[model samples]
Target: MPSPEETVKLVQQSMAVYVKPREQAEHVRRVIAYHLQSTVEGSRPGGPLCLIDASANISEPYQGIRGATQEFFKASAANSKALEEFETVRKAHTQLNQPAGPVIKPNRYEILDDKLHLINQQEKSARLGTLERHIDILSEKPATNPDFLSLKPIFKDLRPLVKVPREIVDSLAMDENADRRDLASLVEKLDKVLLKSKLLLTREEQYLQTLKSQISLDPRSVTPSAKARALDTTRNELINWIESELSKASTNADDSDAGHDSDSSHGPSTSGEKPGEEDEVAKKTRQTIMTKLGTVKESYQLYVAARKSLVAALKEPVSMSARPVAEPPVRQPQESPATTEGSSGTASYLLLPYLSKLSELTAAQKAVIAYKSHFNVALAKQLKEACQIIDHLVPESQLLPQFPWPASERAKHLNPGSLDHLTAAVSDQPDLSSQIKPWVFASDSARIATMETVAESIEDGQVGIESINKTLTEIASLFGEVNGDSASISQGDPWADLALDLGLLGPKPRP
Candidate 1:
């Protein structure tokens, strides 16, 4: 029910409510990691690996927060999915309005009634002749004509519903029957004979109603203006539903966050390490990491906002000229101005509105494209920076469990005798994260090969802007951008599928 502008504002506000707290939680995790890294830097050989305990304590709760945030974003992404569905339905409605040639089928009930009347008339005529011949003293021949041919075709059209065998109906028509009881028996069963026919007619009516509703046209009655209004109402309701869901999700997030905060306050510190033990450098590192995390989070929020704004803008109705223009009549060599003046004047008036709307829509389209391109470039850069920081700080060798990578070359350095000591020792290695990536590749060689083939097959500029952004995010999340390069090798989701959905490529045509 809300206006488009109001709905967009509500969505933005709802997203922000969920996003802000999540950003804070992410910042806290980064701070803990930064401080632990500083502690690891200063620790002596053979001494306790105290930083490991700090990392473990912070990680458990942060994992929960991260999961909640991911769910919130996933729910928010549903709005985009809803919009896509609306667009598909809208397109189908547009197709329904397009000029289809004259239909062969009329109201099924009308056709059936007419066929029944013709058959009944023949039966009545034959009966009258039989009765008349009963008292005939003045006839040369008591002619009894039973029209079996016409009745047979009508019965055939009714199909399995008209269960009377062709032979039985033919016998009733061709053979003269004077007994009223015999003729009455066939007349009485006609309703039973057309039971399936009635059911089929009902089904046809229901189907027609479905098509009418989908295209926002009334089956009972419809005019051009009424159809347009119906379409507008449908569009508004879809947008309203999207906004309502977003609002509900935001409210639920707030309630969940409130409970989480209450529990955190009452709960004892779950960290392995005691508090007040971190050095000055470790404390400073925590503060610095928090600041950087905030910056990254803000950049991400900005990116999300821009994308939503584009979606909102696209939802507003584009004034399309739906009616077809008739081709102008060919002019005689010396046609008078007055003769053509009325039609030409009318066309000019119609075209002015259409051309104006087209120009406006075109300009809006260009603006949207420019904005999206710029935003994507910025977002890609931000993702690259964030990934670099995460990769540099979090040691992947320490992250993975030992059993899963027993024979992995990356795990060879990890000793069973002093697992904790080995973990801490490997965390210091500069190339440890880089080494882990090779292990991933080795483990998922077949999947990697498939993904690579898909990526290679995809031609450039084939993917939709939205899908491309999503793909980039997935890539960054799984395998952070390395060496300032935005390109990444994905372990899931073929790049070719994304291109195919965008209509840039399709299945190869058969010969």
Candidate 2:
């Protein structure tokens, strides 16, 4: 009998020498292919091992000769056993060459599902245990504890499950044996778990509500038709209301004016009127009424314009009105000297009485009077000096030469006091005093000095100490009242004596 290695060598040598080299290579290739094929096939459950057995047969082939060959056959059998062992090892090598099962890739979802299943199983087991304990307690006697009272329902619910253990049921039937305290504690724990579950459910509901509210507030949530209708309705209502109010106001104004006219015409009856006196009074009253009517009409137009502007401002699609530039207050023409005498007398009468009776004059009134007196005196002085300068500059004889001779007696009689004479004189000499008037009488410095004097006098109470100091605070305020360009004292300057004496300034300490 040959060893497994020797048998293998014999098989190789026979194939190399007896067989053609191509045939031998082909047979070796077939043997290797068959081994590989068998390995793949053998790996499967209950697959064939014939290709592996065939390789063993080739390694230890049978020889010829009855007795000698019989002995050789027995040896060959033994060798075949060793060869089979070698074939087994060769088969293992081929198996190692075979592709393995798909590489074990991790399936995340599968892992998660497995974990969830495990958790569910654990929860079921715990719940079942709890149920079993509850049943065991109930089986004894009914527990008096409140905790056991809660467990009674759980045990009752599991009554239908026949798969429950008989021992658990028997224990539950003898439940009075269990401590009442233990049962109550279990009930409390279960209540806490239920509370946590309810809280989680509430939080989920709140999250959904928040999402819904956010969606509603979005501008896109409103329909176009709804927004358009709201705008249109508001605009129409505003226009209609404005029109109605305007009509009512116009009617009221017209009625009031008509009433005033009627009342003026029908003057109060009295026993003192002469025959034609009534007629003259009536005519004057009618003219007065007509004048008042014109003023009323102008005021009414202004009111209407203001009302229109307000209405337009209030409208939904707010509109603006063209603002009218306010006209400056008109200055009345200066009266002639003769005419001024009467008006000034009346003005003085009206003002002087009121002023003399006043216990305390306002700082403004004191300032005004001081300004007026100062201006009048300064103006009179300037006029006299101007007349004197003109007299010195031009001789009477030269004046006539420079000026035109009068064409008529009226012209010759022209005096400096008369407006006509002044006009004629100016006309005669185109370059008369008008050209040098500004230089001859400068008012800038004098006006400033007068203002300063007035302000100082008002502060120091130079005019009336008792009266001005009574309102020293009020007078001090006047310093602030004066505008930037006007005469204003420094912040801490003492009040003038004249101003304090006049009682135009506020109260001060007694001297």
Candidate 3:
């Protein structure tokens, strides 16, 4: 019963109520709870009514999010009536030029599922995403050395890996208390070693700085080569220790063949002790360990490189030279279009076809927007969507989803004699090579099929104010100025004006 504007305002207000992107499930739960509460009370707040429609169904979109909970997605079959009128509210979002996400049917989970707290799906999902993101951030070229304070929060998160809470362990059917405790002890050792390594790295850096300063002030105070060797030996010992600790991670018979890697992509290949007992928590803990170990290893390598570079510079002194005078840059002359560049210059305009079609699509969309009560609005919308779809089905990308399209199946088999004959015949027929080509996704086939469908729809039209072509012609005619002057476009239909200028359309009829 709400207006489109009211619906959009409500949707924004509800979604804007400070829900994290990953916490959308909790948001949905709250929204549905609010909906039920408000419905019973007959009090509609601007908040929950945002995502609600005339049918009162909520839309849940989970794809593309890293740790999205699939179990929470609302199924439509539970309520057929609710989703039928949901599109009106969604259409209002489109009117505002914003995506309303997917409009799915509300499922029975809202009423049936009371074990929400026991399941930890949303919380686990959000935390897993955070862990993965942490790994990813570490993988990138770090701006600064990995600090202990920053990782303190992560260590707290990793605590679950060591000590599984009684409630979670009971619900998830975790390993026996003894085995979990052993695994916890091993992880706790690795964490302690890592903390020690961070402290050791800080001390080594300070030591290196002192050595460099002593050598710079008194050339004979310290041997650059000796100091560099000592620095590397200590760092390598610590690095190897970290590596050895990581290598001790539990490996099952099946997973024993896997390699221990510092790369986040191959995060913690080995699981906890007794792989049979290892759950998602154990796996995540190992991954987080590997990620931290990886950062430490990287810091070590960086320190060694910087120390070595500084040592090498100290060993070899370079005499300063005068700077060379800079020369002015020479700009090349622009080529004229009249010159025959042989497709080199023209390749940039490959998107011109899509651009032209897009122009027409925008005009059609605008026409529909201006006259919402247009007789052919539905047809126009279909055409607009089809045009957009067709535009995106670019060359070679939109291949008919085929599986196991092997080399033999993909290649056309022709005899040597037949090939020779065909090649000879291609001299007679210039288009033969293109006609009898190897397998590839055809560009024109999809466009033609889509155009044919549009053509059929235009023909049927359910009887338009003027037929489809008549409307287009009427639109085109608007570009024709008074006294048949093609110089000035009268009604401002750029497409029509373009067609007239290009001589694609005939002269307009005189009034």
Candidate 4:
């Protein structure tokens, strides 16, 4: 039995001698670096000698070189002055060995041989053939790189190999069997393998779920070629369904309209009416009348409602205190005498037929009219009182001159000249005189009443000078002032002569 140090040295010696191929040297260097960083001495059952190879073709090699390397590393310690020269020599050697181009590639056979060597080293300590078989299966490549078909068998072998580490092996003979003595090792190895398998399965399941989800959401389905046809069919089906629903909705809407028409045509029967006895033609005529009446009522109500709303909207309260006091009412031009004469002519012409109708009235009608005379007398008295109040408020000085009265151009046909002659002609007949008298008196009474009211306001001295100035200002704003540059006329003051000329009273004398 060789010592562990001696075994490592012999292995390194065999590698350097018989396996002196270019690729072999590179692989040995990498393996050496890996073991130096990883393997602990005397930790495993076989100690450091477990990582060695002993085949019948190769002679037993010593592990003294590994021991020497370890010794060399320890010799160059900190605070040792001689170690600096050794480091310099080591660095120079590493620089000289560095290749100029990329690292050399290893042959496939060399790589396989290296893997076999690793397997042989592991097998020396324990029968780990399952692991070796797994590596062999992974290493074989088919002609076409073995598409998806080759994955099944590889996965099946890998699944079993992952469990081999948990198999109990005899400590002395290294036989595969669970023994109480190796139970702790078996459990630890089992735990590690199970944990690795669990992690792998978890990642695989996540990957599978992602693949399945991607396939389901694919717009092209599983077959990319059918994508265009599928889209067209889906669009046509949606349009057909929409058209069908629209037709059904339109049919329902028409039925609803028919029901509404029937209800409207069969207007509600009155209290005593029976449905069957009602004539269809008469019912239609009644419906038409009711519809017209309803339309008229609706229009009239709308007009009333709109007028009320407008009146309410415009009824803004005026602040009496803020407003200047009311001035005497200004009188406007009266209708000319010629206008009155023309009005009499037009009135007589229009009333001729009414006078003819009055004569046809029975004597009983005239007797009934006389019976209502007291009511007409009371109305006349009330009118006279209103006229008195209006006459007291206005004054003559504020009145406008009577001129420019309106008369129809056609009035000349009734009277070529002398309006008095035309008036007398209309007044000659008793029936015509009675009819035209009221119209003539109504027109003259309005003018005389206006004149009387203006005369009363002037007598009461209620005329507003500010009102006159405001009126003058408004006129000036529209037509500009008579003399804007005059020395007496300020920015907004009225013309001094305007009040006198317009017959407006001058400013009230100061108290």
TM-score on alpha carbons, each prediction:
0.16, 0.13, 0.15, 0.12
RMSD to native, candidate 4:
51.5
Q: Write down the lDDT of every candidate, Cα atoms only.
A: 0.54, 0.56, 0.52, 0.51
Stretches of candidate 4 exceeding 4 Å from the true structure: 1-225, 270-511
| Candidate 2 C-alpha lDDT tens digits along 1-511 | 4466886786676445334577875885566446555545645424422224323443344455344334434544655666665677678756765567866879999999999999999999999999999888887765755677685677775646458798887877866756667887798567544544554456568878988887757778887666664444443344345545755766786676667556545644433445466557656775786678557555544544454344444453634776565553232222122323444454555555665667355666567655655664466457557767766755533333434333563344445666656764633323334434433333444566689998998877755777666577466556444445646545555754225345576644244
Error of 3 at 90 (Å): 99
Per-residue C-alpha lDDT of model 4 across residues 1-511, encoded as one tens digit per residue: 5566875685566445334588975785566555655545534333342233222222224355566345423332321323344456558756766788899788999999999999889877465677777677877755436565676766875645544333343334554655555788888567545544554566568879999988756655555335533443343344334445745765775566567557645745434455444456556655675577556545544543443343333454445567454443232223222323443455546656776887777566556544544444455446556555445533441332232223452244245475655654533312333233334545576688888898887766545666787788788755534553532344355553345455675674233
- Residue-wise C-alpha lDDT for candidate 1, range 419-442, written one tens digit per residue: 544554533323334445544654
Candidate of highest TM-score? 1
* Superposition error at 474 for model 2 (Å): 99
After the best TM-score superposition of candidate 3, give how far the Cα of residue 432 lies from its true spot, in angstroms.
Answer: 99
Deviation from truth (RMSD, Å), model 1: 62.8
Relative to the unseen true structure, what is the C-alpha lDDT of residue 426 in candidate 4, on a scale of 0 to 100? 35
lDDT for predicted candidate 1 compared with the true structure: 0.54
TM-score of 1: 0.16
Native-to-model Cα distance after best TM-score fit, residue 418 in candidate 4, in Å: 99
Which residue runs does candidate 1 get wrong by more than 4 Å? Answer: 1-338, 396-511
lDDT of 1 at 183: 67
Instruction: Write one digit per residue (lDDT tens) for candidate 3, span 134-210.
Output: 88888774544566448676677554557768898788885566544478879856754554455456556887999
For model 4 the TM-score comes to 0.12
Residue clash pairs of candidate 3: 10-50, 11-50
